[model samples]
Target chain A: MTSVFLLQWQRFRRAPLMVLSFLALTIVFVMVMAGSNPGNSMTVPTYAHPALAEQQQDEWLEQLNKSEGLQFELVEEQEARQAVLDGDTGMALQLMEDDYRLLIVADDPNRFEVESYINRTYAEELRIRQLEQQSTSGEARERVAEMLEEPALTVETQSLEGEQESFVYDGQLQMLFGMALFFSIYTIMFSLMKIVEEKKFGTWNRLILSPLDKWQVYMGHLLYSFTIGYVQIVLVLVLFKYLFNFDVGDQFGLLLLITAVYTFSIVALSMLVMGLVQSPQQLQAVVPIVATGMAMIGGAFWPIELVTNNMLLAISKVLPITYGLDALKSVAIHGRGLTELMEPIAVMLLIGVVCMGIGINLMERKR
Target chain B: MLETEELTKVFKSKAAVDGVSLYLDKGESVGLLGPNGAGKSTTISMISTLSKPTTGDVRLDGRSVVKDPGKMRKVLGVVPQEIALYEDLSAYENLQFFGRIYGLSGSRLEQAIQQALELVGLKERQKEIVKTYSGGMQRRINIAAAMMHEPELIIMDEPTVGIDPQSRSHILEMVRQLNKEKGLTVLYTSHYMEEVERLCDRVYIMDHGTIIASGTKDELKSILSGEETIWIELDRPYPELFAELAAHPEIVQAAETEKGIKLIIPKGKRILGSIFQSAERHQAQILNVNVQTPTLEDVFLHLTGRKLRD
Candidate 1:
């Protein structure tokens, strides 16, 4: 076992380009996620003499001492603008006049209530001032206040259909999972093809005819491929977490479990390819075509949602990558608990076992 | 002792190795001499457990290899016709890998590798990758790799093919040394008759997937004793000389060329003097005269009606 591990390590060491690709992919992921969102951008300062402007506005409002009519508060321009837009505040008062007269800047285009309030208050104030010149009458003041108090219309905001945010994040997580699955499968298949090439070149025969049993040679190759696939998955996941801001949510344990399952399935599929194909070139040309196509249709490169029909979806559901992606998406993006993802996880595990059984059977048959 | 009993291998409809039986005593060097496609390599492959014989059984010390190849594999070393060393790996590394596969490890493995390399006279250059070595050097290392496990029986399938004469001789010498000094039984296969004649204690000449002749050099030579081979060189020989040589009572076979006439006489010593006297009468000056014993090649030609190379 130690020798097998050492041999595998040697194979990995020899394939530095693959490792470098994984690292580069992580960087690309980080770059894409970091640069895509604009909401995270810093705010630009647009205020000039903000404190002085607020003080002047407040002092001017104080001078218009008929405070019973209406009043405005000095606030940050952005905050004030937002409140007006949201219909939280009636209107903003930047300046006011004092001759039983008043001025208001109507931020809302349909400021009907605020306008009425201003009009009635001004009228009442004029009447009070005139009455003060002669005789102050409480009945006249009450009449003016009564005229100002117009009935207000109540409005309720609601939508007929409930809003459900589309599972876009789930889709993205599926894509990442799909990519990881595809890469892992591709790596294992490629490694197997490399071994076939070695065989064709007589390198394998040299090793086999040497005092080694079939198992040692097989295990050495298996370890090399397994390590490659495992590393590819790790790199893709790390990239998802950091670069894509991919919330592989919180299920680290579930993610690891899914990853292990996917790795085994891919490795077993590779062994099947190796067992069936005699020539290295044949293995190389055929494996990626079949594996990549399966992954694509199974929703690795694109979301399964794009295939709207029930039949295609049903077919995708049966694919190993589909189950793998589903489990990953459930764990990573939806933050689904383990129980929620058990079905897909179980399917993935089953696929791994079935593939392994078939792969070993095929190998034994060849022998 | 290694024995193959009625061993046969069929590839599709054609028999690659027909019912063939042969044996090599322990510590004895036996050679399989045949032309290309003579099933020499196939026979070696089956005997070494690298390939399965379609029918028949191979036994090492009376233990059936067919029933339990693993047991046979344990005691067998194979040096294939093609150089089987890993081109990318150093000679020592290749040896180490094979040694480990044969269940040699630790200091024992190291000692075995060293001994094998020394036996092949390649210990000094063992650190170099096999690809970096000359063709002959690679061949030597190829054989050395097989020897690493120090198996009781060594099977070499045309180990000297395509090698230079010096390297070929060196490999042959190494094989002889291994057999003589270490008492390692060897089943050597080659097309070169001289190689077998030099190194093999016994020779089996095969053709068309069947062994046609098998014996010691002298024994095989004795097979052609009824016919004496006579070689005569002349400045110029007439076509009629062929007829004249064929007419001799003792001459069993005759072939004439522009420069000479070769006659196979049943009793050469009695008839050679008469043939020379007859040649003198025909005004044929004998530039050279020689009477020789039959070699393995002659035995092969006599039995198969074709030269070994043909």
Candidate 2:
């Protein structure tokens, strides 16, 4: 195993550009995902009524006019609505129920400040209206303010295993996991192409003719590819964590375990590629096409929700990347604990086993 | 000792190597001689356990290689016809990698690499990348890479192909040294008759995936006993002269060359007279005439009815 690891390290060291490329791409992905909008599902508005349009406009204009430092722009209602929908505006004001209705759009799920600000402003307006109607004293308004400032109730969710939802790296973990899965496929294809090139160059024949068993040769190549995949994941995770503050979640041990398993599965897949391909160019073309296609359908670049239910989903479930993504999202986005991810872990292990069996059989047949 | 019995290799429906049997003594250097696609490589591949024979058995030291290939693989060093080497790696690194794969390590592996490099006369340039080396140097290193394990039997398949004359001579010398000094048995394969004649103690001539002939140099030459090969050098001659020479009853075979004509004839006094009469009738001037002994090329040509090059 040490020999295999050393050989793998050597191969990785020889191809530093690949390592750098994977890391760079993962950083880019992490940044993109971290900065991206979580869409309309997570956005919460301050008010829900649809009437009182002119009253809200007059109030917003007065507030903007009194502001000394901030720039203000008042466009037509339709344009403002379009801007909010297009993720161009953060919030839009409209009239409803003889009061101001603030339409707050959160481009990021973590932007709770804007939503809270809108909610507090509406609460203050409601309190002022009540004081004017009932002649409440200043002290009573202060008390009302104190009551309104109390923290919201928090609800904790857990998986079926009774473990708390631990996935909490702010979605960076999920993005990193997805990108790592994407690059694992690429690494496996690259390694298989290298094998085919070695065979074309006749180096494989020499190695086989040596005193080493066929298993050793196969292991050496697998080790090299495994290390490549492992290092790629590690570098991407590190870069995202340090450079972009992209969270990989707090479950470091579990993340590493999943990465290692994913590496093994990719390496096994690479061996199978080597077995199936007869030429270097063929391996280059076939492995990437198959791997990238699998990744696309397996939810590497996008969520599996894009594919919905179909044969692709069924096939994607069998791929290690699908399980990796599920586990990663659980740990990173939903704050799921290790005990909650046994299913994805098991799926990944099953993929590794199946791929390795096929790969080994193919290698033996190659002989 | 290395031996193969009734070895056969079939690819799809084509038999690349038909049923063949041969043996080598503990220190003997045997050669497999044949033209391209004669199954020499296929035979060696099976012997080295790089490929399995469709039906056959290979034995090293009376132990079945087919039954226990691991044991045979440990004792056999194979230099394939293609230069099987990592061009991106330095010669030393390539040797070290192969040595490690063969389970050689530390001081033993270092010593083996040094000795192999010395044997091939590439010790000084071992640190240079193989791709940077000359074709001959690369070929020598390819052989050295195989020798790192110091196996008892070395199987070299067409090691001299595409090599320069100097490198070819160097490789042949190394083979001889390894066999004579180290007592290493060799199964050398090539189509070049001269290389086989110079290096092999015994030879097997394969054609169309089967051993057509097998014998020592003297035994193979004896097949054409009592027949003398005559060469007549002419400055310039009419095209009809060859026809005239070919029509002679005494001459068994005649071929024209740029400088001369070569003829094979039976051991009879009438052949020289008949050749002279034919040359005179064609008005050809013979500058030099010499009678020579038959070479392996002659034997191949006689058996196959085609020139060795053809």
Candidate 3:
């Protein structure tokens, strides 16, 4: 086993693409997220109607501040319209005499909430004015004001892990975590592909002919994948925390723990693919489809909260990376501890075991 | 000592190797000779523990290696038909890795690597990656990788199939030296009869998986002891006369060739008159007529009624 491990380590060290692509891909994701969001925070920017009266403008701004998690900005009416046209602002609004008009960009994840918030805010203000006018008597008007002060039915969201952060959408940090978890599977893919390579090149048969047991060869490869994944995660996280001043919460050890288990599952999945494919070239076609599809469905491309489709959310739950990335988020952003992370970690291990069993059976059948 | 008892391997309802039994004494060099797709590689793979036989057993000094081949593996070195060395690693690195897997370590592993590289004549370029080497060089390193562990038996399966003539000779010489000077037991398999004729003390000729004949050179040649083999190369085809000549009772076996015909006849110079008369009656121009003693090739032809290569 040690011999196989050392050999794989040497061989992997020679594969510069593995390390280079990991860093390059993570960097690209981080930059795209940071560049897209203002101040590199996850909050999408919002602006009130610039045509409103100055006094009403302040009121509208105040309401936006309390309505959602967006960062609200104020600008002239023409400037805001142009911003929307040029795809600068996430959403734009115009207040007409009787109703309001909103211009939304295509396929915005937050379109529904922004539209709902603006419409609700405007309708509520109009409804209050109507109530004040209709109730002319001092007692009735005072009652209307009191009722508008706070709604009788309101929800209070509580964080089970820890303190609720001011902005839940730190895009830069989420992108880092997503990409870290997403691309970590590539190592396992490459590692498992070695099985095909050995068979093609006749080395696998030679290894079998050697004195070493077959289990030793597998252990060496699995350990290599796990170790390389750990190193990649640590490298990215360290760079973000120190060099880029990216906050990764306080529970870093838990982060590593989740990543380790997640990587184990990824390696096991790659083995399953290896057992299915007959050649390294076959893996070339298979790995991208499986990895990309899983990552896309697993919400690695975007936050699950941002995914509005219930069916998609269900699929994400079934993907191993979904739990992995979630546990990572719980550690790096939510400051969650081991117990809070138990669900995802356990699910990942379960996936690991199932994939490993199936992979071993398939590989054995091929032998 | 190594022995196989009726080893058989089947794939998709057809046997690739069928009921082959062979024995090799310690310090003996044995050759397994067969054409392509004749189950030579399959037989070697089964013996090397790379393939599990469908039935029967392969034994190393009396211990069956069918179920658990650990002990047998320790004492065997296998050089596959393919260039199995790691292309991304240096020759020395490939040797070191194989050595470690064979349980060598520390200074001993280093010594093994050095000795293997020197034996393969790749000591100077040991630091270069194997992919950078020529095909023959890669094949040499492949052989070197097998020898790093110094097993009791070295099984080479068609090691010189595709290489420069110089490298082929170099490998043949190496195999001969390893067998003669070091007294290493060898199980050499090849379609090239001359290689086996020069290097192996005993030979097993296999066709379609099973061993058809096994004996010393003289003993195998004795299969055609009472017959003289004749080769006649003609300028043109003589199908009709060739077919008629094949029906001759005195001719033990007759095969028509692209050029003319080959005949195995009972030993007697007087039969030459009848052969010449038949050729003349067919109006065939015999450019050359050669009579020779039976070789391993002739023995294979006599037993299987087919050429060793075809």
Top candidate by DockQ: 3
Assess the local accuracy of residue A149 in candidate 2 as a C-alpha lDDT between 0 and 100.
Answer: 82
What is the clash tally of candidate 1?
Answer: 5
lDDT string for model 1 (A174-278, tens) is 545666677667667776665666556555555655556677777777777777778778877876687657566777777888887777777776777677876
lDDT minimum window of 10 residues, candidate 2 chain B? B301-310
Clash count list over all predictions: 5, 9, 1
| Candidate with the larger lDDT of 1 and 3 | 3
Q: Per-residue lDDT tens digits of candidate 2, residues B156-224?
A: 989988979999999999999999999999999988999999999999988889988889999998877
Off by over 4 Å in 1: A1-5, A11-15, A18-166, A169-175, A201-213, A239-245, A308-318, A360-367, B226-294
lDDT of 2 by residue, A1-367 (tens): 3443454455456556765676677667666774563321233222223454657655644543442322335555676677778877576655344445555566554346444554555566666667867874647666666776884664667778675543233334545677778876776567546667767778888767666566777677677777667877877776666776655568767777877877777777777767777777777678768777877888877777667678988898778788887777766656678788888887788878888898778766765
Clashing pairs in 1: A29-A243, A30-A243, A211-B101, A248-A332, A249-A332
Best by lDDT: 3
Identify the superior model by lDDT, candidate 1 or candidate 2.
2
Q: Please provide, for model 1 over B1-310, each residue's C-alpha lDDT reduced to its tens digit, 9 standing for 90 to 100.
A: 8899999999888999999999999999999999898999888878877678999999888999888777777777888878765576688877887777666889999999999888889989988877899999999998988787778888888888887999988999999988999899988898898989999999999999999988888899998877767778888866666577778776766666446876666653587678777876777778988787777876776677566776
lDDT, each prediction: 0.72, 0.75, 0.82
Tens digits of per-residue lDDT for model 3, B198-260: 999999999998999999999999989998899999998899777877898888877777787
Candidate 2 docking DockQ = 0.51
Cα lDDT for residue A196, candidate 1: 68
In candidate 1, position B129 carries an lDDT of: 70
